[model samples]
Target: MGRGVSGATVVMSRNKFIIYIGILGLLIAAGYGVWSTLEVGGELVLSGVVEADDIHVGSKIGGRVLKVAAKEGQGVKAGDILVLLEPYELNASLAESRASLKQAEAKLAELVAGYRKEEIDQAKADWLAGKVQHENAERFRRRMGDLIERELISHQDYDDAKAKAEEAEQRMKSAKERHDLLLAGTRHEEVSQARASVEMARARVEILKTQLDETVIRAPVDAVVEVLDLEPGDLVGAGKPVATLLRTNDLWVRAYLPEKRLGYVQPGLKVKIRVDSFPQKNFSGTVRRVNRQAEFTPRNVQTTEERVLQVFQTEVVIEDPDRLLRPGMNADVFIPKTSS
Candidate 1:
């Protein structure tokens, strides 16, 4: 009876040892399978976040902010008004410049036309009268000189008549010169200078207009407003950042993969992306670019090793982007082999 009990206990111990060995063997096989899968394909994986193109909008001139046309998170199109600076000063400057331009134009026209016809006619008549007076003076001087020779007139009187003839001749000459100058148009140099002045004034007006236009800030591209730093009555200076915008359409994910997997990761290669924010959702994308240089693992990434040892940065362009995959949202990328 004791021998039977000893045989039963031996059988139970042998069976328990066999079961434990089987379980251990199964665990080892499974671990080996997982390691082999990782080694054969170099399944490099990385975590990244979606990011859009960041842009800063600023003013070109300094002035007090008159209006803020955008708010944070507002979608805006190209050329949309984003801000308005106080335009009173610019408008006044423009108006003054335009007035100066008009005045310059009027003066230029007057110079080109020269003296009026009536003024020229009056000058000519004066010249003719002076000529006639000089002729009479000469006759009187000749008559007086003969009288003086015959003692019929005094030498002083003859000398005085001769002086009158000379003075009349000089007056006629001065009158004729004035008439000719009136008939002739403006000098070439004078006309050129006048035209240049007009052009300069016109250019000044245009410059003022440009400055006024700049007071009304507009978006350079389609984007979403990310920041609004100034509102009505706020003062700003040239190149002062008034807002920030993000180009949603230009969004992409930046990821890194192990150097060993570089052969499979090429531009234009298809990829599958899954964002932690939307685990159930899967996104299709293509490799837009792969950095040729290797970099250290980002500080945000954690692995069994303190560093990734070696990795390359890559950009994946989403085929279809939605509002849910916003900038800074963490994502996972799976780059399947060509055969897979």
Candidate 2:
């Protein structure tokens, strides 16, 4: 009877101990659930960095830097000069082109207007003189021929007279042709050639002018100068970046959302933004875009098996009317949570 009572007591103790362990495990699981809800269940907020479009401003035509018109961190508007290069050669070339264009235009005008009245008169006079000389030579040649036929002149003398007559006749014909050409003025072909030359000169001048303008490097957009270390006499090549600018008109936050939470946000929806610089303040931002391609990247996870997760990149444009935000700032973006 004593042994049975002891055995029953031991069995009851073992059962009570098992019940206590079961109750402790339930309590621990409940605590963990409550903690997870407090930590990340309320909102889908994530961290992001502020970024802006960086523009590299430079000249298409390279040259020795004459002057640095703007410095780093300087705010500039469109068309503001950021640097100036030596344009001495370009200016000289432009002037020379302009003079050539003027000369070509003058020639074209002259050709279109024909020859002067004085020139025409001079040509006509020459033609008439040639005709008189030719007639005199012809009369002499006839006399020489008649003398040779009658054996009154030597063969050499007759030949000389004949040659003079032929030369005189040729001179008269050339003179008459010159006079006729002067009367006809310039041909259409000549006028067209002259006009073409003028156009070519003008085109060269325009190209030079454009290069001269490029020597003065100007801001293409309204931005703040981020990098401008150049000074006078710094030689740079064409299309080399001389200055870096950060556009202040639009700032964006680059964020990565997990593929599982992709449906939580879409474009055109507003979200809350906060930065460490102004933790108390809240900034408004709109979703700009979401990348369609998912990438495998490591996320903050405790277990090694859950280290990598698929995520999509998202761009959110921040709206700051007061212009307080800048690039490279750490911002906390609160993504709205949705069960669906």
Candidate 3:
């Protein structure tokens, strides 16, 4: 009886020992399987930050800033009023230029229209009077010639009358020439000169108008105002940066990935993104671009030597960005393998 009891106790002990060993082996295999799943054909996450398109707004002309309509962090659209400059000087210049142009145009019109009607009538009357005097002189000269031939008058007196008749004929010719010129109106050369003057005046007016229109500054694109450099009564110089704007619609993240995974990462590949600011949310995005060249990681990045040894730059663009994501915000991107 004693031997049977001992044998039974031994069998129970062996069974318990075998069961414990089997459980331990299963636990080890499960741990190894979990580790292998984490290591192969998995997603690699890279760190980056959100960025926006940047721009600088400048003034074309120098003037005192009369009003600044935009503030920092303000959203604006194309053609929205951004700034207003002191336009009094520009207005005065434009007015003066317009007046000068009007005067020039008036002068040009007068020149092109030709001589006055009264002046032409006066010339005609002078010509008629001179013709009458010439006819009277010719008749008197003829009579003097006949008297001289008949010996009724001295030769000196006949010569004097002939001279008077010739002088009267010359006066008539001069008066006729004056009448013809006055009736002909303005010459082609004079009209051409007047037209040129009008064109020059118009060009000046147009230049002044362009300058006046530049006084009101408008936004060039749909963006957010990043900076404001001037206020009311502030003097701004030509070519100086008045404000800084950033395009908010096309936001992208700059990241680096291992060169070994270059085949999997390409433009148009879908990606998963997470921002440090929004820990609970995951952003959907795509690989918009990738750099061809490989470069070392920047010294500022906190990465292991293996990761920094060689990496390729990549740009991921977010499809639907909300107010939460902004420029300079830290982000992490997950690039899944083909099998994943």
Q: What is the lDDT of residue 94 in candidate 1?
A: 86
Give me the displacement of residue 60 in model 2, in angstroms: 2.1
- Tens-digit per-residue lDDT, 86-153, candidate 3: 88987888888888789878877877787899999999999999999999999999999999999999
What is the C-alpha RMSD, rounded to one decimal, of candidate 2?
Answer: 9.1
The Cα local distance difference test for each model comes to: 0.80, 0.85, 0.81
Give the lDDT of residue 289 in candidate 3: 86
Top candidate on lDDT is 2
lDDT of 2 at 64: 99
- The best-first sequence of candidates by lDDT reads 2, 3, 1
Candidate rank order under TM-score: 1, 2, 3
Q: Candidate 1, residues 1-340: lDDT per residue as tens digits?
A: 9999999999999999999999878645433221111322633455677888888888778799899998999999999999989999888888898999999999899889887899999999999999999999999999998899899988889989999999999999999998888888667788789899999999999888888888988889988999987768888889878889998877788876665667877888887877878899888878899898777644654665534345677898875555666888777777665523
TM-scores of the models, in the given order? 0.72, 0.72, 0.67
**On residues 100-217, what C-alpha lDDT tens digit does candidate 2 reach at each position?**
9999999999999999999999999999999999999999999999999999999999999999999999999999999999999998999999989999999999899889988999
Candidate 2: list runs displaced more than 4 Å.
Answer: 1-46, 135-166, 264-284, 296-308, 332-340
Clashing pairs in 2: none
Query: What's the true lDDT of residue 133 in model 1?
Result: 95
